[model samples]
Target: MGWLSDSPQLLILKDCLARRLLSCHVYPELRNLPESAQGEELELADFSAFLAQEVWPTLPPSFREASFETRSALPDDLDSVPLDSTPVSFVDTLVSYGITADAEGAQTLLRKVLAEYVSDACAAPPVWSSTRARECEICEREIPLTYHHLIPRATHAKALKKKWHPASMLNAVAWLCRPCHTVVHQIATNEELARSYHSVDLLLEREDIQRWGKYASKQRFGVRRG
Candidate 1:
C-alpha cells in the first residue's frame, strides 16, 4: 500500500517484473523491448505508466480489472495530477511525509508479498463454477460438463474421411467436467481411446489419472464420482 510508494527498491523490482511481462511473446509490439524501447528512453516510471495506460488495456479479458493497489492510499488528488509528469519518484513523495523504507527491508518485504500472492492463488481455486446436473466421473469437479466421445471423435472422423463410414459407435459417450475432459484427452492417445480406454471404468484404471483426480479436488483428497 503506502509501502509501494515509500519503498524505492520495491517499486523498481515491480517495474522490472512488469518489463519481463511486456517482453512476453503474447504481446505483439513489445515482444522485444530492446527493439521496441530503443527510441523511447523509458525508465521504471515510464514502464509503470505504460503498464497502467498502454498494457493494461491490451491484457486479455481475465486480467483486465486486476487491482494494482496493494495499499490503502487516499484517492482524493489522484485524478488531478498527471502520473507521467509527477516531478519526482514515488519514494520522494513518501519522503515529503517523513516515511523511509530501507533497501534491504524493502526487498525482503517485496519477496514476502510476492510469495503470499502466489501461494494463496495455488492453494485454492480462484473462481468456481458448477455443472449443476451431474459431477465429473474423473476429478468430480462440479464445473460445466460436456458429452465426451469416449472413443476419440478423431477416430470416428478418420473412418468417415478414409472409407466414408458413418460414426459406428453412437453410444460411446461420457459425462465429464472440463478439467477431467482435459486430463483424459491429455493422458491418453487416440489409439488407446478406441482400443482400451473407451469407457469411464477403463480410464480410471490408469493409476496416474486416478491419482491425479484424487488430488485435484478442492480438498486435495480425491473423491470418486461413481
Candidate 2:
C-alpha cells in the first residue's frame, strides 16, 4: 500500500484524478475519510466508477486489454521511435493520453514497461533504425543484403517438432552481403549451423569466419574468395 505512492504510473494516475475531480481539496483532505463503514463503501464505489468511466478509456488499447503475462511478451510492432532516441513529442503524446504527467514520469513508466515486456526478445528494440541494415552485419560491406537465417531453414520443421529452437527464431536473420553469406554456409553444414552458430556474434567467434570477414570486408562486392 505504501509502495503504491512511489509508483510513477500510479502517481500520474493520481495526478490525473486530482486534476479532474479534486482540485478544490487539499492533500490532507484526500487522507481524511468518512468515519462510517457505509460511507467508506460509498466512496469506494464512486472511485471505482470514476476509474471505469474516466480513466480506463484514456489508456492505450494494448495496455488496457492485455493481461500482464500477455503484455510481458514484446509485440512485433513496438513504437518505432527508438527508446534511446525518444523525442519530447513522444513523452508529450503519452502525457496527452493521460499515461503520465511529465517527461520524467513518462520515462519512468515507459522504462518499467520496456523492462518487463522486452525480456523474451531483444533487451530493447533495434535502436539504429527501424529499417533493415544497408551494410552486411558480418563484414560491414555496403552491398545488397540477403537474409541469413540464424537457424538455417533446412532445420525449421525438425527444430519446431523437437522444440530445439523457439518458433519465433525461425524467421530470425542477419543481413549479410553475398560473399559473406556464401562463406558462412560453406564453412558450416546446416545441422552444425543450427547447433553452434545461431547468432552473428557466435559466428564471429569462430577464427575462420573472423579471418574471412576481415578479408571479405576489404574486397569489392561479388569478388570471389580464393
Candidate 3:
C-alpha cells in the first residue's frame, strides 16, 4: 500500500489527475491539457491544502473520508451498483474516481450519476412547472424545456468535486432547446463560450439575458475577468 507520507509525489500527481479529469468535463478548453501534464510535480502539502480547502467541502461526507489506500483497494471488477449506495452527493464524482475501473462499470456509473443529478436538478417546483414549455434557446422552438447545465454533468461532477445536483450549482446552466443544447456545448467546448460560462452563480441563475452577459464577460480561459 502507498502511504500518503511515503509517496507524496505520486499522491499529488493522482490528485492532480483527478482534478484534471473533472475539469475536462466542465471546462471544454481544459480537455486539451495533456494527460501527461497531470504528472507534473506539486507539493503534497500544497495539493492537499487545495483539495481540503476547495475540493473536500464539495464532496459528500463518504468521499470526504475516503483515502488513497481505500480507493486503490477497490476491486477492478466491482459490479455496477446504484450511485446513491456510494455515499457521494453526485454520481459524476464516483464515476470520475472510478476511471480506473472496467469500461462497463464506468458507463453504468456515469449513466446513473447523470440521470440522478438531472432528475434532482430539474425537478421543478409546482410554480415553475407551468413555465417549462417556453421556446428553446437556439432555434426558439416552443416545447417543454429544462435547464441544461452549460457545463456537462460529467465535467461539473469533476469540477465541483460534488455530485451532479442542479440545486447545488444551478448557476452553471443555460436555458436551451434540446438542439441548442448540443450547439451550446459545442460552442462552449471548442470556442470561447466555456470560459464565458465559468461563473458558478450566473450559470445557476434562471436563464436570462443578464446571466448571459455575466457569462460573456468572463469568457476567457485562465483569466478571471472583473
Write down the TM-score of every candidate: 0.33, 0.43, 0.25
Cα misplacement distance, residue 132 of candidate 2 (Å): 2.0
Q: Worst lDDT window (10 residues) for model 2?
A: 120-129
Give the candidate number with the greatest lDDT: 2
Residue lDDT tens for model 1, 19-58 = 5434434333333344345344343344444333432223
In candidate 1, stretches whose alpha carbon ends up further than 4 angstroms from where it belongs are: 1-133, 157-168, 219-226
Q: On residues 1-226, what C-alpha lDDT tens digit does candidate 3 reach at each position?
A: 2233222223333454345444434333333334424433333233323333333244344233223323433333333323334224233433444442444553453444333332332333234333344555434555445676544554654543432222333344445645445545544452223324533343334365444445543444345667
Candidate lDDT scores, in order, read: 0.47, 0.58, 0.39
What is the total number of backbone clashes in candidate 3?
A: 13
Better structure of 2 and 3 per TM-score = 2
Residue 129 of candidate 2: its Cα lDDT? Answer: 33
**Model 3, position 128: C-alpha lDDT score:** 30
Q: What's the number of clashes in each of the models?
A: 2, 0, 13
lDDT of 3 at 75: 33
- Which stretches of model 2 miss by more than 4 angstroms? 1-131, 222-226
- A best-first ranking of the candidates according to their TM-score comes to 2, 1, 3
- Which ten contiguous residues of candidate 1 have the minimum total lDDT? 62-71
